[model samples]
Every structure is written in C-alpha cells, then in structure tokens.
Target: MSLHMTGAGALEDPICTYPGSRLPVRAPCARLEGRYLAFLGGSETFGRFVATPFPALLDRRLGQTCVNLGSINAGLDAVLGDAGAMRIAAAAALTVVQLPDAQNLTNGFYRVHPRRNDRFLAACAPLTELYPEVDFTEFHFTRHLLIALHRHCPGRFATLRTELQRIWVTRMHRLLRGLGGRGLLLWLHDGDDSPRSDAPLGSEPLLVSRTMVDRVLRQARGLVEVPVTAAGQLEGETRKMDFGPLQRPTAEHMLGPAMHARIADRLGDAIATLQ
Candidate 1:
C-alpha cells in the first residue's frame, strides 16, 4: 500500500517500492549479505495497511536481518520469473514463503504478465472453446476473467477450476522441491489450514484444495497455516488504507497488524526449529 493523502489533506505514505524490483516491498531493502532471513510472497507479506508487517517484526524479535521480498498481488510467476529476487531468497539463512493465491498464476487456459501476475494476457484455444460466446479480449485481469467465465458457463468454469487445482498441485510440488527443504510454505487467511471449500474458485487462491496442500507437504519443510483471529482482523479498522475508492473493498480483505504479529510468531517458531 503506497502512501496517499486523504481528500481532506492528510498525508499517507505507508507502502514504498524499492529500486531493483518493479513491485512494492518494505522500504530500505535489508542487506542480503550475512545471516539474513528471506521472505517471499504476495500482498500479505508486503504488509499493505499494517504499520509493521511480519518481516520487520520478526527481524526485531530475532535480532537479525530479514529481507522482505514480498510484492503486492504477487503470484508464483512473479517470484519465479524474478531472477534477482529468487537468487537472494534461495541463498538466505532461512526462507519463509507465503503461499499466494493460485488465481494469479498463469495456467494452460491463459497467460498472465510475468511480472504483473494479475494482468491477464492471452486466452488460449482451450479457454476460448470453453467460452466461445465470450470475448477473451474483454478481459484484462485474472479475477475479471474468472468471474465472467463463471457467470457465462458455470459447468465449464467448474472444470477449468478443477484443472487449475491440479496445476497448482504440480507447480507447488516443483516449487518446494526446488527450495530443497528450505521453503516453509506459509498459509495466511481468515479460515482453516486446509483449502476445503464448496466454491474453490470463489476465493483468491482460486481452487487450492486441502488435498493439494497435503500433496505439497511431502516436499515442503512444513506448512504454517495462520488463520487470522477476530481480534487480529480488527487492526485494520482504525488504520487508513492506501487504496483508492475502487480498491477499498479489496483492501478490506487484507490481514491487519494483529495478524502480522501472529505470523511473525509462527515464523519465529519455525526459525527456532531450523536452528
């Protein structure tokens, strides 16, 4: 969340994008040298409206450097494609990767911008055939495309959603394997550790089922699932958001300060085990 002044004339500069990466990360990128901790993930890890995201907090608690490599609305594609960022994370003393929503990733039916994972690029033949009546050109974002598809043809959307889950499973397995037991998958949201849901596509991660998490666990060091408690959810209530009018709704869904503390604690525990 970038700083933005309210219409009344209050200055707000919460989120800051550093040099190097196009995405916004915690300002003053921590030193990569030495025994530093590396965190890789999406907006949650970036600490949108929350004053102190988990990475900064964890650094203070551990008396060590923790580099926050999180980007807003990041998907696996964004991190995987970022050679510089991934290179840093892979070499960190300890790495905690936040499991971003699967919806932002590019799959067989569509292509997402490598850096901007949310930006929908092209619709392949498979997607077109599934929704022949829909104009693929009209879609510019993954969320928009999925919503429109679901509305146009629920059955076809269901099938597509299922395929996405499978893709997520396979890709996640490869990601964990690549991390070499260093990757500790972190799941942060309002609900349970598992992804069980009637409408898998209804959420941000798209269709990541519990079974998918279970499968990835084989390669993952462990999955730290932190469901924000009601109290933690209230931290954003009094805080002013960096979002514009159109983005307010979505911003509300972001985890708050209380949740960040919990996440930091979870990571601290994981770090202890690693030591």
Candidate 2:
C-alpha cells in the first residue's frame, strides 16, 4: 500500500534529520532535552498525508514535548541504523514504536536499500535460487517483489516468510532492549480488531503474525493495538488526506485524520499510565 512516488512537491511536510541520524523526520527538530517523548515508525508515524500526526496531537493532549522521529518506508535496519534517532529514543520518557512490516527488512534471502528500506536493492543467492524464474530487476519496491514471489511460488514463499518473521522478532527485541524497557509496541492493524490471520502476503505490517509479536513483547513496557477497519479507512479518504493528484492513490490507503485522532486518544491514555 506504500507508493514511494512523489508529486509536484506542492505538498510536503517540514522534515529534518538529527545530528547522528540521516533519517528524515518531521521538522522543528527536537533537541536532546529533558522529559520528551519520542515516536518512531514508518509513514503512519511520520503522518505521511496528515497535517498533524498523532505524535504532535499527543503533544497537545499530554502537555509534553513529543518528538516525531518517523520516516517513510522505515524498517528495522533504518531505525536501528539511525544512531541519532536511537539516542533520542533512549533518552526519552518513553518511546512509542509502530510495528513495521517484516518483508521490508534485509535478511538471508534479500537486501534492501540501507536508508529506504522499502526499495528492493538485490536478491541474495538463496532467494534467487528459490525463485530462479523471477528477474530481480523487475522489482523496485519490497512489497511488489514479495507479492510477485508469493504468486510465482507460494510454497517457496513460505520459507522466506518464516525467515522474515524470525528476523523481525530478533530486530524488534534488539530495539526494545536498547530502550531499556521503556519501549511501547504500537500495533497499527488496518482491518479488524480481532486477532490477525496468518495468511501470507496479507495487509500492511506484511507477514508479521501475532505469535511473532508475542515473542518480542517481554522486552517492551506494553503494547497498544489499534485496528482501523477498511470501511473506517475510506470514511473521508479524499476529504481528510493531504496529497497531490499523483499521490492520491497512495494517500487513500493511509489512515485519515479521524484515525489519527483516535490513535492519539488511545496513546494518551497509555502514556498517562506510565507518567
């Protein structure tokens, strides 16, 4: 659902990077100050098409300085590689981490772009050998590559899925431990509030299962699961989102302003318990 294409540059959010991290985050950058909250994730956490993302809304809701360290298409490597962002998370009162898709990360089967985790840089020997028919060059994004691979060979795709889930768990554990147990896992599910099915190549946060989440929960302070139903997502898609004509399709799949407000409300309550 993430299209990394840009429009006429007519609509852009203020963004900047920290001294030690090259990740582009929402701007009016946060200083390494005292008692601030750090929010980390991909596009949703970055407020891709929304004017005021939940992080900024939380700032007003809680009367605290909330730093938005979100980057579009960011995965485990992107987050872990950004020393500046990690440092901010370490020093924050609490770090809210949105669970990113397992497929976007680099593992034994493939390697993704260092900064743009969504871009498919190259497929490793194992992956190439698994799907010897597919031309790796045909793919530009990880999601596209994964979908094609699954459609080409569902059986073989299972192996890659298992590896991705495992790697995601390990990386998530590393991130949580780095936060000194001050991390809160935010599970942003885009379709039902009930338990997520293990169907391969499913919705966003692709290939990640509830079991994988449970494996990494011990290292986190808690988990906040927010489900945005399909109908709910389409409620005011065009009306509430901010995007140019070229970005319309991508923005439609994104959470709207109403959902962001709901996320802020839920996170505010969770954050209050910690304070």
Candidate 3:
C-alpha cells in the first residue's frame, strides 16, 4: 500500500523548513538623536509587571525617547559586554543603571529572548575577554574568599574585602566616565530593615550603609544615587509601602503597581537633578 501526505499536513524535511523568528523592533531612538534617554539594568528596569515601567514614565516626563535595554536576570557582565547594550550606552544623553542585588552575580554574559518576556537562560558568550579575570559568577565570592584568606593567613580578609570593594567602585566609575560625560544615575533597591523571613538574603547589604555610599560617591565622577531604604528612621512609612500582598503570591517577585508608582515618583525626582 502507498501512503502520501500533502499540503500543510505533509511531512517536510527539516533542512528545507524555514526557521521561525521575529526581529525586535529596535526601540525608538536607538541612535539616541534628538531628546534621548537610556535605562539599563536587569528585570526591574525591564518593568516585569506594570504596563508602563519607570523608564517609560521618565520618557513621558522628560519628553525624550527612552530606550530600555534592561534584561531579566542579567548581571553586570551581560550589561557590559552586550553590543546592543553598548550601543544604547554610547548613544544616550542620559542613562540610568540599576545595580542588581549582590546575589544575582554571574560569571558570563547572556541574552534575552524577545518573545518570552521575562524568561532568561545562560548565554554561551564569554565576558572575560572585555572585563579580564573578573569573576561575576557569585556574590558570596568575596565573603568566601575573605574567609579563606583569613583561614590561610589570619587577618587578611578585611583587607581583601576592602580591596574588592574598591575595585568594584573603580570599575563603576570607569563605566560612567565612558558615557561621554552624560548624566549617570545609580539607583539602589534594598529594604531598610533586615531581610524579612520571606525575602531571599545575600551579600549582607553592601550599599545600605552610609560608609559604602560615601566610598562609591567618591569614586564616581558624575553619579546620582536614589536611596530606597533607611532603617528605623522611616519605619512606619516604609512598612506602608510594602507590596507583598499585591504581588501575586505564586507568580510575582517584584514591586506591584502602587509601589512602582512611588518608585517612579522618587526616580523622577532623581532625574530632575540632571536638569
């Protein structure tokens, strides 16, 4: 007996089949001409939940086209090495870079699937060629390295942590410098209080302290920081700002609509400093 398949039902050779894909519409103002702004960071900057992200709000406020190059689960290595990221960095008149929590560090650069929304997976790209010897893999590396050094040499870890922090501050300074003296804003998103039982804890709150803030400020040539948390000083107000219930218990891990509006207002104030 002979059997045949035809039309859309026909079995086609894999080699002959067209691969499916869609090109991302280069976000308007990719060239950064006219009034332009660029927001670069990880998931939060990408605006996971709300229909409009803070960058879009800022774009509306400033009357400038804001190009968002934020990627979900992206670490510093990915941000620094991506050609498209670099393009956005180079073209912007103003840029906002939100540093991810120390816990999210990774050693390699990665890519985001445009259609998948918030999904991210490991990228085969090597970032060390540009960064050189810097391991962006784990946030605890410094803590562990310090412990190891202390165990091996005694009283060496403190010096080492300080040195590592200095290196990070310096690298950040250099990154800002390369933006052609454009306004560079650094926004920190951390709770003022100690990590609640429900939150994932990491790297012991490096930027939450005033000393670290001063150190970072000294190194940065043109940097603006928006402080999100303050322990005890504004406890009542901060507690009122919590969005835990608003975030879908099973699905969401970020700020909700009300919290985002507050953040947008604060961010707008920071952006106003550029003016």
Clashes of 1: 2
Residue-wise C-alpha lDDT for candidate 1, range 39-132, written one tens digit per residue: 8887788877666889999989999998888887777888777667767777777678887667677888989988768899999889888888
Return the top candidate by lDDT. Answer: 2
Q: What TM-score would each prediction reach against the true structure?
A: 0.85, 0.92, 0.55
Output the worst ten-in-a-row residue range by lDDT, candidate 2.
Answer: 191-200
Can you write out model 2's per-residue Cα lDDT over 115-141, one digit (the tens) per residue?
A: 779999999999989998989988999
What's the C-alpha lDDT at position 44 in model 3?
60
Give lDDT tens digits, candidate 3, residues 1-275.
12234364432211110112121222322345676777766656665433455677777777777776666555454555455565666667677766543322332343333333223333324433433334434323333432333454434334434444454455455556666566355555553524333332322333233444455555333444444433224324334322223333312344444444566677677667766
Ranking by TM-score: 2, 1, 3
Task: Give me the displacement of residue 270 in model 2, in angstroms.
Answer: 0.8
Residue 181 CA error for candidate 3 (Å)?
Answer: 3.2
Q: Give the residue spans of candidate 3 off by over 4 A.
A: 1-31, 103-167, 191-210, 218-251
